[model samples]
Target: MACNGSYTVVIVPLQNSLYSSDALRFFHWLKKLRALEREKDSLWIGLQVLERTRFWYQHQLDQISQRNARVGTRELDEEEESWSCALRSSMQRVNGSLGSLLNNAYVCSAAPDEMDASDWCLRWTNAVLTQEVSQKNDRISILEFEKEILLQQRDGIHYF
Candidate 1:
């Protein structure tokens, strides 16, 4: 995420299941704001991102219900397992990042005079982005481990 030559925004890998084109556009817009040193604009965009994230979650849940109704309560096959894992990881990442943003917003609101507004906004945005990247990395590691376990299980079944 190199944005214009001013700064690099490290973002989490976009989960295909959750992030729509509009969401991605908003993220890029936020990055552009940061690049231009428009911290206030970035903060407002970040709040919109949070709202979009909530809607994404609700949409995902509704889709899941519809899928389950169509498929019944059968055990998930490998593809479904992979999709479910990715969805769960994305949901967790979104929740954690949103919570961090809300907490930072509260702290900033409670003591507006304690720090420069631009500085606070920049810091909060950076913190949220950092947490999202960390969570995505963790999810990747977990998914890799699960893959290894599944491969081993398949290999064992072949031998038996």
Candidate 2:
């Protein structure tokens, strides 16, 4: 008995070829390095955002402290009053968005019996701003550490 069949033949590259394997490993290493670089860039951007936020908080804190200092037993002159009013208006805008820290809102609700409403509000706002600044500082530190680690990893891959 005789059997008739058609067979198709195709040639494929050897899986264990040294150059192909080396090229594959090189591409993989490049991909890892690129990922590490992107992570480092993101961390840098985060640090910058934290820095800007901290600066804004510091500016607000300074304004609040200045107002606290300027509030005294003696009444202000017209010029001083105008400046104080401007500062107060600016601070009010800040507080307005933060759930109205002034105008007898949260501060008055939680204030001690002896504390005046405005005084309590300023103190409360100052405390909150201070905490925000500290938290931003902590986050900046953490991002910096991560960026440093990412750099080291990227360098290792590059040298490998």
Most accurate candidate by lDDT: 1
Q: Model 2, clash count?
A: 0
Candidate 1 local Cα displacement, residue 49, angstroms: 1.8
- In the range 1-160, model 1's lDDT, one tens digit per residue, is 3224545556656656347986777676665555445544455666777788778878988988888897766766776677688769767876786688678875554323323546766777797798788779978877896898789889989999
lDDT of 1 at 44: 61
True lDDT of residue 123, candidate 1 = 78
Report the error of model 2 at residue 46, Å: 1.1
Query: For residues 3-24, could you state the per-residue lDDT of candidate 2 as single tens digits?
Result: 1332223344546764787667
| Model 2 CA deviation exceeding 4 Å by range | 1-19, 72-160
User: What local lDDT does model 2 show for residue 90?
Assistant: 51
TM-score of each: 0.49, 0.34
lDDT of each: 0.69, 0.58
RMSD of each: 15.7, 29.4
